[model samples]
Target: MTMEIPIIEIKGVGPETAKDLEGLQIATVEDLFEHFPYRYENYEVRDLSTVKHDEKITVEGKVHSEPSLTFFNRKKSRLTVRVFIDRYLITAVIFNRSYLKKQLQIGETVTITGKWDQHRASIAVAEIKKGKEKRSRVIEPVYAVKGNVGVKQLRKIMSAAFAQYATQIVDALPEQLRTQYKLMDRVDALKAIHFPLDFRQVKQARRRLVYEELLLFQLRMQAFKMLQRREGKGSPIPVKKEDAASFISKLPFPLTQAQQRVMNEILSDLKKPYHMNRLLQGDVGSGKTVVAAIALFAVAKAGFQGALMVPTEILAEQHEVSLKALLEHEQVKVALLTSTVKGKRRRELTESLKNGEIDVLVGTHALIQDDVAFHNLGLVITDEQHRFGVVQRRTLSAKGNNPDVLHMTATPIPRTLAISAFGDMDVSTIDELPAGRKEIRTFWAKHDMLERVLTFVDAELQKGRQAYVICPLIEESDQLDVQNAIDVHGQLQHYFQKYNVGLMHGRLSPQEKEEVMVGFKENHTQILVSTTVVEVGVNVPNATVMVIYDAERFGLSQLHQLRGRVGRGSDQSYCVLIADAKSEVSQERMRIMTETGDGFKLSEHDLKLRGPGDFFGKKQSGLPEFKMADVVHDYRTLSVARDDAAALMHAEAFWKDDSYTALRHYLEQNGVFNKERLD
Candidate 1:
């Protein structure tokens, strides 16, 4: 097929220009075809007298005089022209468009769309095209330009690609669906999207392309689930209600209705024959861990091994302690393994795991190591799933034979993100807090209020409650003048001479971090100064105060997670943010944090504040990137596509049918056929 042909085939595109195309990710004909425009320019002529200053409007006119060009500011050039619109000769100023001077003659008609400069009685040219047709105004595609690749160059390349490879653009959506959806042809849509004849064509092209992209993605997700089902049914773990009742009875407090509901959903998945893929999401300290504990207990009660993988060693240790305490009476053997386990200890732990001596094994990425094996693994649970990518999650899942997977995240993801990122998995949320849990008293103070904050921390410490002092940076940086953990640790230690303040940061060894966290858990350390490394599942119920320096520098989600470090116990908790926020966004974030303790709401605010690209902050969440579909705004289309894909897959023998052959081939070509990375 010509789809994989290189980009050097264009008429004037030499080696250098072809290399520049790589900056736009256009190396192959397929890449060039998929390099969709970010926006379009509508050159429909409008009345000049109606629009106000600075409003973008299109005008039809003829050149009144020969255009003039002038050079300025390094290599910049400008072209000035007088266009006669109806009876009025209006001046048009175009920047860096020297080529326009040659084509514009004294009487040639032109269409100009730009911002109106009322005082100057002219239009600042945003786009100028040679056209006079009133009914068929050109809707020009605007590709994102970078490096040396300009709009003209990209347009030429796209035109050449369509001329040569239009026949190769196979319609992944079958004829049946195309007719049913009243969509445009695949080739027609591709051409009209780049060079549309009218507004109706652009609308049709966009709808066809958007639906195709979204449908293909949804098909991949559902196909993956179908393939997993065909592989084999998982070992069904029967729920023992009596044992669960006894376990709950031994707990110090009652489970919230939310937790009970999630537990019931998980238990339903466990007893099913097929492998269950579920996502458990909730606000931090909302009793997610206890609910996961109950599910882990059910897995062990079925006499099959379960592995619970977390992102950090401290979280692993914390889970280990909590699980052992909760499962002790039930005779469920729980074990911990991490990078710190080595030599004789490592060998013995792996051996015990292989022999099925451990009912639940908790650890960090170490659980996915090749040496770690299971005798009869049935259930796999991963905590803080965003910190681990699909590779790690699937690697751990591969250790078991068709194990039921439960992905837990304390950092609540917004519905837009959750639906798109985890659309394939069944989602269960623990929205309500447990009984006796108090709302964390949140306060935002300027840097000058540190003395009062310190006094409050001193009072909390005097009551034998520990505190956490969070700094944004681990080391002093010349770029940012924010507080570092080392400096804050020293200052706190000096201020509270009687209290033992331990230091922790990312640079410390895993064993050292474990030691510091253990000391804090044991009440030996009254305060721990650290970076965002403790932003995940570190449960120290004794810690009642979290003081974050330069809190405005952090995202609202991060601040919420840091606040979650406190308020784990029954006693009232507090979070102090010391920042003199100058930006409106930062000040708004502070206000939001002080106003509510809902992580999901804070995450939605964070999404709006930072947008989709910065929301995850370099973490992999297994979200598929779409060419034309915007998950934030096109969620309705996403839902429809999901339903269509599901309904199509649910049909009998759909994969083997000829009408669905193109879709199956697309799934294979798009890298969705890989089973290991499907999760």
Candidate 2:
């Protein structure tokens, strides 16, 4: 395993530099190769005629004036000169480079790249081409450099690594598949990705490398799924549909088609002798909770306890209240556990849970504590499951003897991500809303129009409907220019003095948060001004109006989640997004929020905007940190590679076949999967 050779073996990377590289998670030769550039900068000359103001461009021109150097602030100096390129004349200034004046003589041709200042007809020169080199600058790979390590230094180290150890990089894709897919050899792609000769080579190499990464990932996932299926060690909980039916009969309304479909899918999995690994994806207000409730009730009736873990204490309490109301009559005892549940109550609750007296336990990460135990645990359900990492989920599930695990997310995930990130699990989508639920009318307004927006909220409040005014910050900050909950609450209270306006933020104690939530839920507060803490699972049907101040500060998915707080009941709901959106990206986010209420569409846009790592905290989704593959932009490649991987995984001799020898060896030696991950 030469790939295991220490990075310090590379020339120019001494012990100090090696320690710095290790800060970036690069300790071995293989690690250095895998540390691909995040982006590439092309210094090729551009057409000056089409260049915009403040845009980076490179152009060659004659030196129309002698360069004059001026010293400033003792150490800083500016070298200014005028150059004419084609038909346009512009001034170029290079800061702190007084020595460049000798090279920038009049009547001499010069080339420079910098941001174009159209109004001033000048360029803030980033780099000045020296000597008579006529061709455009080389396209350079840009690595993510932290402390001590510079980009140029990293690039040098990478080139050295490639020079010495690239031959050790084996081609995992068989020749037949590579030929069919028109992919480059693994060694060539890795070399090109690190030191691409041109933009075209970068693209081609990226295509090949992205495919390899995604294929390996999918193979790992499919293999895990196959192994789990073969094991079949899960508790064979009886599918007590009759008990679920009786509970549903007592409910105020029947399950929607999507809910029934997903519920049946989950229950059917429970009936199997093998453990169920499934993802339940639904829109913000698509009734996913009801489906979860039904599953839990069935599990409880089967003489086994269920555990529901959420991200926040407020959400845990809310789930406990709702689940209790839904299952208490059926003699199913539901309890809440969080950091707030302490001392005597905590001990009593845990003891009841161990004794099998509590049929269902709902809580935050507290459910994963070593002290927490479940008697005959049959099912584990996590609400808004994306907020918890894989380790947390596994630890909670480990408390039981191979219990069925159901992960749910209110944020609708795109199909591409579902196939890659959660590829190991079966997927169940709830795309339909309840029959009587109304579409939430969304609006975008400038911050200056707050008076008019308040008037609308006032009208809604007058009609006996409550409202929510959300801000980006809990308190004022010296850095960010955004609305804060405390100030907004004060302003709203002053304006709507006739009604109570409640305020909530993270700094508040758990009891205070509970009191505020209870006040708002009971309609004791007409308007609730809060921060993003209310995004997860605060359900208030009577509140029909949602006004988000500084809405542009939020992502599309987040805005959609906040809007889901309303629109729960039959009454028409309205969401007003008030912001001083300056950037086009922010404006576009606001426009999309007003355009449609589809969480899937918004989530797709969100994925494209924020990427999968940020969209679902990377560790929580267990998505690998891919260097070349982008789940959003490269979805087509992802799909093709996914299918190819599935076929190869299902092949008769994938593990032992000679054709797949290189592939299996590459993956195993590369350490793609671990015991904890597979389990």
How does each model score on lDDT? 0.85, 0.85
Q: Which ten contiguous residues of candidate 1 have the minimum total lDDT?
A: 670-679
**Per model, how many backbone clashes are there?**
0, 0
Residue 43, candidate 1: C-alpha displacement in angstroms: 3.2
| TM-score to true structure, per model | 0.83, 0.81
Q: Where in model 1 is the C-alpha error above 4 Å? A: 5-23, 48-53, 60-113, 117-137, 146-149, 163-168, 179-182, 198-201, 240-254, 335-358, 363-375, 386-400, 448-452, 619-622, 671-679
lDDT of 1 at 535: 87
Candidate 2 Cα outliers beyond 4 Å, as residue runs = 11-26, 38-163, 224-232, 236-257, 293-376, 386-400, 419-421, 617-623, 666-679
Residues 1-679, candidate 1: write the lDDT tens digits.
1277888976677899999999888898888888888877766677888779888888999999988899897569999999999877789999998888888888888888899888888999988888675544357788998999998779888998787778878777878889998999888998988888887888889998888888888887888777677675877778787767777888899988898889889888888888889999999878888988888887788788888998878788888988998886788999999988999999999999899888899999999999999988898999988788888999999998889999998888887777678777878988887766799999999998899999999999999899999999998999999999998888888999998999999899878888898899888999999998888757888899999999999999999999999998879999999999999999999999999998988998998898666678745545677788877777777888888988887876466688777776677776666523222
Query: Candidate 1, TM-score vs. the true structure?
Result: 0.83
